[model samples]
Target: MRIVSRRAEAVVFGGRGDVTVSPVDLPEIGHTDVLMETRVSVVSTGTEGWILTDRFHWGGSMPYPLVPGYQKAGVVLEVGAGVDGLAPGDRVFMTTSKVCEPVHAFSGGHISLSQEIQSEVLKLPAEVSDLEAANLVVAQVGYNAASRPRIHGGEVAAVFGDGMIGQMAAQALRARGARVVLCGRRQPRLELARRYSADVVVNVAQHEARWALSGIAPGGVQVIVDTTPSPDMSLYLDVLQPRDGQVVLSGFYPGGLDVDADALQKREVALLTNSGWTCERLDATLDLVARGLLRTTPLITHRFSYHEAPEAWSMIRDRDEDVLGVAFDWTTP
Candidate 1:
């Protein structure tokens, strides 16, 4: 017998410039599934922002309304009959699920998401709070990009854009003992960079990359992670570490980048385009946060309940700087 509950809720974009919080079907489980009662979920500015504005370019999309969100942390409420290594009371960091249909959930983190997400779901250590784990996707996004070049202890790494991914990337690199530099056009975001252990924060509003980078790394940064949607990686090619510098493009774009292929070949700089993240990366990110090595506390700036999703969406959309991070409080109504 298959039973589906309809008590879940999701924040969906109407595709007609409207956002709403409406009832969705609570996800069910097969014999190998696990059901989670969401405690908290995070709003990824780039991903969620794009969804709200109709600018998101996800490769897979359901013909239904776009239900926005991917990061969620919660407690396991029920375990499938044959599930092992997890109990009903265990706390975990979960991504989206397809439990809620007709909503076209992108990771289904918004509701009572439950499925046999065996490897993708990682048990939260006692030290890490649900609030911090809820933002794991952002950390994984940064990890996915920074891991490409492999910042081994002493390399100078520069993360472009002071947004969530940029800040997260900077912290992730710093955790690896990299001399981290965060470059952005805003001061407030730059200020937030300090809390995550950024070695140097530069305001790139009108600054020259060559000057700023040289001032920080002297011999030029070894790795550069571009977290901005802007595709002008060539503008910062001079900062690449002479012969074998590596660049990781981790940002999302509605279109292609304007680049200079000649510049890449001449510099012998290797560019790696980040293609989201994997389950293993997510586990690694969670472990880092759990150990207090990589701090995400500074990134979370606002909290919103499920009912306040519209307001939360509006704030993240309109007030981009003041609200650097937002965690959806799903523990309540």
Candidate 2:
């Protein structure tokens, strides 16, 4: 099929802490690519917020006026000639899109229409809705953390952080048959984790984490997953099993990661870091969500129309309200 010039409305990070919705030119659909019209796109609160506020440390300074998300759920509008597995009208999820120069695509995802490579897209199962699949990448981070450590069915696992990633990690650990202890300062998020993900919820603000963890797993936790940006990994040394303990670094540490090598060496703890997503991992996460093993709908606390992009950003950036699983509905106009 012949293609023509097209434009898409995107959420652009103009500069640090500046967000604007502007029209960006979209490249013509190419072979081995799929053109999609977005139905919903969710925010990776930690990652996107860091990038928007210019705190992300990986790539130095992120170029301004760039699209700043990597999670999008959409419907296929057209497919490239070489694309055999996907066709028009299929529900899909995709990563980055190719946008015309001048405006950069820093792993593009939040846009009205996106042209994604075939390899970067995944077809959704009928049981999983767009909203649930919208946050697949973030959910996969949790899955990655839970999947890293080797543990038995009844082993104890402690997850630090009550944010989306933390909650999701707790759920993933539960799905893996571990007794999950979710730790966080927010009561509401901890309550949700208690009901959905965690067997025990620890309000670290009130009581000590080590004290709370001691009652659950006396010997030591089989694995400790830190889902916060700047967590001191050594704080939980005594709580980790001497030889079999595992620690998964699931959050991005822009400031820099400090590990207590001597302390970890004494215990022979396995330290693993997880970021981004793989096609296999994404597929597995979607299946777990589809099968109702990993709950997604319950964690969602806020939703906004696509036009309310600015308002949504305000809520996420300022934390004026307790927010989790924020989604923008493009179909709402």
Candidate 3:
């Protein structure tokens, strides 16, 4: 039997509003390989959204014609030799890095862990939906972010930015028994933060956020998680308490931060940075989703088809109509 497969991918053509979708030949499945017919994929509202709008600070030298999605959920249409426990028609989570290559060859550049693709492709639990699994990748990042250092019960944690990741961080922190205070400029998003377990939501756009946070916690917050990249890191630094506090930078800020070194020294705050989730943490996140303890379904505010990818990016870029967690619907075959 002949298998004809065409993969439609999104690439940056030139500048903003210039995205091109083209069909690429799908390689045959190798041993230990699984061919997934993608049912749903998530548009990373933070990273990909910024790239689509050309707001990315990586200069124009960054790789163009890049496949702009990292999180995808699909059904296995074909399974390779020696692959056990997974069959055609089984749902699985697809996690890949920015690049991948044949295992034996290993002819690619320096094999960094981030670039190494770990296909911990497991069958999706019966309770999980395609959209939910697609979002699980990001939720894993949030989970790992919260799991780091492990906040104790009754601890005060401040999550910066009420975006998807920030909201997820708030939920994770709350699950760990931390009283989360979500900070963001958008009112609607801040409200969603509260629904996701933020004890208090501060609208930076409306009022002085630092003063508001001080009012919420007179002793200062125990932990401050920055999920939105701001040029001024002082906003987060000011909210921290003296001695034994922590600041987790989960956001991508390409610029330099203007902060008071003296203040950080005086406060004895521990600064930490987290990129994405490790393989182990990803599994833990999946377990949380399977048990229904973590719910990302409510975070999805908009959905679009593969053809509507450009418009989807625009929705995030223009901040159109209070779009929160956007996902691409690939369920239609």
Of the candidates shown, which would achieve the greatest lDDT relative to the real structure?
A: 2
Whichever of 2 and 3 has more TM-score, that candidate is 2
| Order of the predicted models by TM-score, top scorer first | 2, 1, 3
Q: lDDT for every model? A: 0.78, 0.88, 0.68
lDDT digits (tens) for residues 1-333 of candidate 2: 476757889999999988888999988788898999999998888889989888886888988889978888989999988998999999999978888888899888889998978988999999899989889998999998899988679989999999999999999999989999998888888888989989999999999988888888888888899998788776678788777589998987777787789888877888988888999999999999999988877888889887788889998877743687888888866
The digit string of per-residue lDDT tens for model 1 on 1-333 reads: 667653667777767457788776655666767777788888887877776666665754434475667778888987777778999889988776654556676656665454446565778899999888988888888877777886668999888888888888888888888888888887887888976748888887868877988877777789888988885776568777777888888998668787787888888888898766688888888888888877786778898888898888777767666778888887674
Better of 1 and 2 by lDDT: 2
Score candidate 2 by TM-score against the native.
Answer: 0.97
Deviating ranges (above 4 Å) for candidate 1 = 60-62, 112-116
Error of 1 at 76 (Å): 1.1
Clashing pairs in 3: none
Model 3 ranges with Cα > 4 A deviation: 1-16, 53-60, 97-120
Q: Model 1 clash pairs?
A: 96-107, 96-108, 97-107
Top-scoring candidate (TM-score): 2
Model 1 error, position 188 (Å): 1.3
